[model samples]
Target: MNNPEVYDIKAKLEAIHQDIKRLMEKSNQEYLDIMLANLKNDLINSLTSYVSDDIEHGLHRGMVDPCQMRETCKSRFTEFLENNTSLIGQENVSKNIIDEKRAELDEIRETAPFDKCDICFSEVNSLFEKQLNLISSRQIYSNTEKKQTEISSIPEELMVKSVLEPLSNKQRLQILKSMASETMTFTALSELTGLRGGNLLFHIQKLLESDLILQRHERGDYMITKKGYNLLLMLSNFLKFLEK
Candidate 1:
């Protein structure tokens, strides 16, 4: 491919990239804040049940000892926090926040039969941890959206089969991506792809047949076409989906 082809593809893809940025600027805060509020309230309810056996019947006796019940309740709630089931961040729920929460919960504990139990609620705030390799999903709506995938449906004139078949090979795909910003000489291509002579020519020929790239002659510099660059951009967008 030549310098002109390289510039053409880069210019086109850069424009599309900006448009995608605008489309993905959706406000995720309102939804995230709502979820956070519901989560805290639900957690309070669950903790209340865990600490108290019978809220309606204060005069009734239960078989479970108070000490055992308190330890079990704390461990259960702490494990749930450590698990991160609701995507609540451990950092977001800090030490100070936990202490404040425990103090508040202790006050809530004094209501009715709950006051009879001597269980301290400190562990409720202290056991948050990273769970199941999940990260904070609060910014979920800020990622590449489902609509971005519509670009995959290429028209026949763009030579869909020819273009994608070449890109299917990792080395050929790399060769095209290497030409995104500038044309690459044969020697430079060989070094980047780690393939020399005839072996390198095989992948290069596939891209040429697809017209996804331009070359001066049999062994000249290579540059990506607009079609090729957009394919790279598509793959990049898809990868962003995987990351989310």
Candidate 2:
């Protein structure tokens, strides 16, 4: 038998290791979320603008030419779909991988002899669900008049509100600001913002859900999306307009 103090110390060390592992996992997740958000936004912006430009150019060339506009829209839409199919495919793959991992982790927790904590399992579940939702909600908007018509029917205020809702918090704003400069891992973002990994992940998930940010390149490091940059610009403009 070991001394009580020795066992206590060992227990403390094991707890510390577990905590570190959780932090690392959460940090990695944050980075991926940010990158995906960026990719989704960029794709949407690219497709939308490309389609819109083609329509406008076609109209200018032949104001009364319905056939020309139709041809232009069709071509642009085809290009957008082709380029983005690969991205959509990747998103599906990532979601599947994450879902599988979550299932495996759940099974491990269920079968392991060690006492599993409910709170830890719940957190893990929530994180995985959030990512999966983000993947599903991720969309690439096209500039075709039909698509634009759909977007236009939705109130602009509602669109702004949806995007701004996730970014309303001070901590989230700080994280976005840090991401605006360069892509950083979740651990890096947490350190910069002085936020713990779990807390940071919660806010990041909100942003991801709102399509204000994205997760990209899921292996070890992550990248931000162009939509995020456009968001930063929108925020800056809103602030400037308020000041003026």
Candidate 3:
């Protein structure tokens, strides 16, 4: 029977186990060690639970698909993390640390090569939905408080000026409109806007200063941020109001 993917997954599982074991040993914190061990066990169970079933059904019948194996195991790991925040010790783990790690892992998953396995992809997607739910719930709580504080502390006049100044330029307006659809690189933006060199850089800087766009550090793609999307919605409403 074809089972190379199983073996490959087993090897990766062992590597992950060893990595956690080393971290646990190095930290020498009993609570942390216990947490890491629990995490490692969860990952093992997630990977191997489907192995026997797959063998019985003849799923891995062809050449080894490395991406499939890796993504499957990694998704399991992520799921464990999302579902088991209790693994974090009351004294040792900060919620901020967990949040940062989750954000980092999610960014990696987003940029990963597309997965062709529908089954594996579905599992990953479900886990992502769970993660998003958790994040949204947390953000709603925190942002409610944060928004109230900002509203009290920040001047409305200043906020209006900051927002309106960025929308003052016709060329910058065009750039923002295009970015609302999809991210573009510097060259793409230049071509789209027919602006280049210092002229393009000036507009991009203006958007950056306004926090309306985010630039990918490695790829240099400029994408609209949440603030930018909300601004666009507000612009639409304002235009409708004017029409009325």
Candidate 4:
């Protein structure tokens, strides 16, 4: 394809990817909320059961009448169990519905036309490698200047390898773009990236291992690390150069 046509196709593919991501996120969030509610309900039920057990023990000790407390605890426990059972059933149903929706979304993303631009990939990777080297050298310089000894110093070659490996994967690149603006939960990343939770988790694990990204404190949220941001900036510059 010609340059303009290629750019156009890339834009279209990116747009479709974004749409798939949004739908996936919505479905994932709904599923997560239901699961969390179910868990909370179960916890509450367990707490009530413990309290009831305590009340029963007290009655056996003759601290209170057995009849009234037994009736009250049994009634409350039954009601609690009933409510939780209903909620759990509803959550299961919702999960099935969301799974179907996610499947459809995945189909769309998979079928979207994405021209494999080997040239683009090559250029991006080259720039990424150069930036990685630069960053490594900078870190060494900073450590020497500070004259503060740490337990272990990060190896220069490892730094380059870490960034290079993830940049080689297109899916990981998409994940980086999705996380560029803000931190996202694992489920959100999966939905937006149209990757199954397991697959997304696998890629994320690699990214984290490479130090290209870091998990935030918000439970399951992830954000690009400083090295990641620097690499992204370098990629942006490379793109600009290509445009020129």
Candidate 5:
């Protein structure tokens, strides 16, 4: 009630969320490209400097053998991991952890295979998991500087209650899950969730009140808002991490 422009805030949040997602995707690809290129250069330099009596030339016809160099680089990377395991407070990095992380990364890759860089996705997940593990093992300082100076223009308690209210129902959660992947019309959503028109409308009104879903003015289709998507994602991640 304090802020008349509630929908405007929702729009701004969604726009910012989309911009950040695009930047992340772009940066991921660039980071992977540069990282692999640097590794290739390093491997070439190493192979070129060392000449065995058996194989006199590192290059075959003035170019590095990519197939052989790739194998050599893998071996070197394995060795590096072995040597630096203690730096991370572990005797050895677990193969199970690597496989688990790879599985999660593969799921993300499969969702948009052509859009994501696999190596970057895998690396990001691995790092995120490691950070979570570290945090669980030790206490970390919380950042409270912004919280100290920030003033809420709206009633903070009211906003919190409104955001949480729609999420407290089983039917509402099912509705959100149904619309997570795509926008849906009232009829389509009703069929998907098997809810009657009257009941579905009631749940939807709650979602709209919370600003978790947006309704199209022209066609009456409903879509999950950015806050809704982030809430689901955060909840999924938190449950997984906490369970471990």
Candidate 6:
């Protein structure tokens, strides 16, 4: 028969092991959370700046009225979208955004734009706020020669398999969205998604393999990686734009 004291000691060891595992998992998750936040902020800043430059350029191009003559501000915004977005291979995304912007151009044409610089800037600021929210992708090197080169350098087959395959399942998407704000253990996830045992694990494994999530250790809590968070953020932005 097994000794009672030996069983007590083994139980203590197991509990201690679990405690250490939790601490390590927490530390790792905190780091990932911070990185994801930074990435999100970076995307916002870049997109905001992209539009701001165009606004400034448009203002500069506005012809000063000679003898208080009225002249309509020919929109650089629409022309900017038509020229710039086509280069990025985001044909559908660009088209949708352009259509929304086009709706506003009719209203904008009513104003004698250069008359009040402040009002022009203020109105354009509102637009900047609305449109920037629609674009949250990694435009890190966007519209630059670097991005043009990077686009062709990427392997088409591998990239498609990696991004599209993992995102194909409803449960896999749920698992990712669930862990966006916090890390989750296997049991907790199974409970949240109503999945069980190996079935739950199979989905988790796909995310892990795709670098979309990180497991603290074997049979440990799962945390979303920066790639995972960024992808979801971009998808959310694009889908919201598409829905309108």
**Per-model TM-score versus the true fold:** 0.36, 0.34, 0.36, 0.35, 0.36, 0.39
lDDT of 6 by residue, 1-244 (tens): 4699899999999999999999999999999999988986776566556665665564445434342432333254445343443323332344355456556655554654444644554555455444444442434222444556888899987777678889999999999999899999988888888999999989988898899999988867899999999999988999999999
Instruction: Output the TM-score of candidate 1.
Output: 0.36
Q: Candidate 6, which ten residues in sequence have the lowest lDDT sum? A: 65-74
Kindly give the stretch of ten consecutive residues in candidate 5 with the minimal lDDT sum.
51-60
In terms of lDDT, the poorest run of 10 residues in model 4 is 84-93
Candidate 1 lDDT by residue in tens digits, 1-244: 9999999999999999988876665435666788988996776555445333321122122212445455455444444443344333332433354355446555644542554343233223222222221222332222323433554554665555676578778899889888999999988989998999999989988888887898866667788888788878988999999999
lDDT agreement of model 4 with the native:
0.60
Q: Write the per-residue lDDT of candidate 3 for residues 117-195, one digit (tens) a residue.
A: 4544455445444434443443432235556577689877767666878888988888999998899889988898899
Q: Cα lDDT for residue 158, model 2?
A: 69
lDDT of 2 by residue, 1-244 (tens): 6699899999999999999999999999999999988986787566446544544443345322344344443343344323333343352344344455556666745743323334333433443443344335553222233654797698777666666676778888887788776777888877877888678889888777766667775634334467767888988999999999
What local lDDT does model 5 show for residue 117?
39
The lDDT of model 5 is 0.60
lDDT of 6: 0.68
Global fold similarity of model 3 (TM-score): 0.36
- State the lDDT of candidate 4 residue by residue for 41-95, as single tens digits: 7764664465445434433342223343444533443333233222322212333
Poorly placed runs, candidate 3 (over 4 Å): 1-157
Give one digit per residue, the lDDT tens place, for model 5 in 1-244.
4475888888899999999999999999999999988985664344323222102222122222344343443343333333322223332344455456457545644654233234433444454455334423322212322443465356777766665677888888888877789988988878877889688889999998888889978657899998888888977998999999
Highest lDDT, which number?
6
How many collisions per candidate?
3, 16, 0, 1, 0, 0
Off by over 4 Å in 1: 1-160
lDDT of candidates 1 onward, in order: 0.60, 0.60, 0.66, 0.60, 0.60, 0.68
